[model samples]
Target chain A: MSLLSVRSLRVTYGGIEAVRGIDLDVAEGELVALIGANGAGKTTTLKALSGMVRPAGGRVTYKGIDVTGMASHHLIRQGIALVPEGRGVFARLTVEENLAMGAYTRNDPPGVSADLDRVFELFPRLSERRAQVAGTLSGGEQQMLAIGRAMMSRPRLMLLDEPSMGLAPLMVQKIFEVIQSISAQGVTILLVEQNALLALEAANRGYVMESGAITMEDAASALLESPQVREAYLGQ
Target chain B: MDIFLQQIINGLTLGSVYAIVALGYTMVYGIVQLINFAHGEVVMVGAMVALWVITALAGSGTTLPPLVIVLIGTLCAIPACMAVGYAMERIAYRPLRNAPRLAPLITAIGISIILQHLAMLIWSRNPLAFPQIISNPVFHLGGATISGVQIAIISLSLLMMAALTLLVYRTKLGVAMRATSENPEIAGLMGIDVNRVISITFVIGAALAAVAGVMVGTYYGIAHYTMGALLGMKAFSAAVLGGIGNLAGAMLGGMLLGVVEALGTGYIGNLTDLCHVSWISSDLAERCAVDGHVILFGSNYQDVFAFVVLILVLVFRPSGLLGERVSDRA
Candidate 1:
């Protein structure tokens, strides 16, 4: 059984449906990527899975239990964390405080501390400026803090929404490397990104979404070589 | 020198009261971002309730001590004001949260008016005098006249401000409050109940304002339905004068504004014809030629001076004395 299963997830904003009956599943310890253009419902799918957006109709099953409309924070406690788009760091809080806030639900003091050290190790820049307010950080540093914060939650499934968005090319590579390292440590990753080439290269499996529906699903290797995906998204 | 000392003490006493009341305005604005115009009415409610406590004790005829009665009054007023605050948030403000921001503001104004009338209808527009024993206690300090009421007001205000500062900075609730103020949606995603935090913020702010109300009532020996209007406006100005969302800034602004007003009144308003009109138009070297003195203004214009300072402060430093940068989230 897959560690997470989202079946026929449908989310609407007023009369407009953002995610239209999409089905996706994340196996335990698997690296899956969802790639799409702007407004292609990639974000909507992540939000539905994290319970930030209530699905109008569908089932979000994590570890065989249906958790469709659970509150987002409650889901975080249950081991799912979503690093929201636009790098939603608490701009006023220091980097350390931001990390502490992410671990709010966890009371295991030693484990949380160890995880903090680990995050700092992974993103040494965050450790260097641990006392700095997140808002003042450069785009790359803020993205690192955002990802590090989600890691502090010790999530079983990390839903990353465009971790590479607005990042320098080198920083983009670094972020993907971190994603790879995180997945290698038995943490399942469901990465949503517009950087189709990098995301597919880093991911084992890929799903291409267009206008609120998944139009293609294939192994990352197949999607990389496909003429249609290349002509449409990779800007061949 | 003695008179100056006395005025300074008096300013400190009054400044403490404004500091306490200003905190309520600041905290409510900090979390919910609502001006909560009905907050002044919460103070009026406190005074009325305290009056009732005094009356109940006195009517019982010698069983409960006066201090016990005062405590009872405080307890009654705190909860009463808190309930009113919670109701205001839940009923009047919560429904309009998603509506235009101006809608809640208008509703807040309407609530303020309703509360004023409600105070009049219940308290009958007659200002109730606080008990004589509590109101008239006096102490002489080194040629400076200090009253027991003033001491209590000062001490109580300090204690409340200290407690509020601790609550904002030290506790888990405080952490949640800061988070809510910073970003409600993100705070919610982290398991903090944003709505409940906001409601609690209003309740706590209202409760503190109630404490200020009771103190003002006891110190002045009178509680009137309309008492909160001017005080509320002043407290609101104090909040803005000190960066509104900054808690420490509110206290600092309140005390500073109080002292400035006192100095202006003491030196400027009370001075009669001390300013020779020739001095106004003359250089320092030519000032000796002035003959007649002209009165610029009168002490009754204290409120106008306060507003003038307020305008100057606004013009120069639009963010207030303490600058706290706000993120444009909503």
Candidate 2:
């Protein structure tokens, strides 16, 4: 069974429909990329899956449980964590405190502490400035902290939204490398990105979304070589 | 010199009460940005609850130790006021959370009115004498005389403020509260229960207000339905003066306002007398002296000083003495 299954998912913002209808599936331990243009509903789909937005219509099942419309916090307990769009770090909190909050739903203190160490190892920059307030961190560091915070939750399935949104090219490369390592650790990932080339390079399978619908799904390498994808996304 | 010392003590006591109440305003404002005008009514309810509990216990003809009686009254009042605060949030404020900013504020005023009337209906408009649980044993510090009650008020208020500071800055729950205050939507995305955190903020604020209410009653030896009105406004001013959303700012603002009022009360008369203003004229001064009053300004004008300080603070540093915390977005 797939780890997450979304069938005909639809989301609306007031009178406008942001996500018309889409179907997708992620098996356990698969790294899937949802790549699209600015308004192709990639972010909306991620929001719906993470329970940030209620779907206008659709069934979202996680591990065979109908978990659609469950509140985001509840979803976290079920081992789903979203590292939200634009890296929403708690700016007022210290970096260490931000990581501690990531483990909020859990009760095992020793396990939480171990996860804290693991997050620090994953993002050494966060460890170097753990005592510093998160707001003062540079953009790249903030993104790293955002990702590290999600990792602290020990999620079985991680949803990353625009992880490389506004970063130096070098920082973007580092973030994608971290993503590949996280995927290698056996965590299923659904990564949403406008940086299609990097996302496809890092993902095992890729879905191309345009105007609220999936236009194509194929192996990442195959899509990278496809003429239409090369012309539209890879800028070849 | 003795009067100066005495006024300092008085100022500290009054400031502590304002600090406690201001914390409620600051915390609620920090989390939801709601003025919570009903907060004053919560304080009134707390005092009334304590009064009722004490009155009931007294009427039972079983004499309990003074400390135990006061403790029981406080314990009962705290929870009663917490329930009122929780209900106010859930029923009046929560529904209007997504409404325009003015909606929750107006609802808060409406709640304040409802609570005031409810207390008046239950306790009547007459002022009730608070039981003297702590004896007033006078002790001299330098030239000023201090009472046991005053010491208790000052020490307890300081202790509570310290504990609250530690809770906000040091605990796991504190992190959640700060995160929610920083950004509710993001905090929820981070797996924090935003609603529960907001509710807890109200509960903590209400509990602090209740303690302040009981302390005010004990200090003044009287509890009245209208007592919270002026106190609440003063505490609100204190919160704004210290920066509405800053915790340390609230405490500082409260104490500063108290000290200013106390010192003004103590010295305004003497200062006016020494000035010998031409506007008063020699003849008017002579007549005033004949009437056993030589000064144009007196303790009656002490309350004015608080407003003047508030205005100056607002005009000069609208963000407050301590800078206000701005919610940073991604």
The best candidate in terms of lDDT? 2
Residue-level lDDT tens digits of model 2 in B237-263: 999889888999999999988988999
Question: Model 2 misses residue A48 by how many Å?
Answer: 1.1
The Cα local distance difference test for each model comes to 0.84, 0.90
After superposition, candidate 2 runs with Cα above 4 Å error: B278-282, B288-294, B325-330
Among all windows of 10 consecutive residues in model 2 chain A, the one with the lowest summed lDDT is A14-23
* Candidate 1 overall lDDT versus native: 0.84
Interface RMSD value for candidate 1, one decimal? 1.5
Q: What is the TM-score of chain A in candidate 2?
A: 0.98
* lDDT tens readout by residue for model 1, B233-295: 777778778878789878987787777666666667437554444455555325434544455
What DockQ number belongs to candidate 2? 0.80
| TM-score, one value per model | 0.90, 0.97
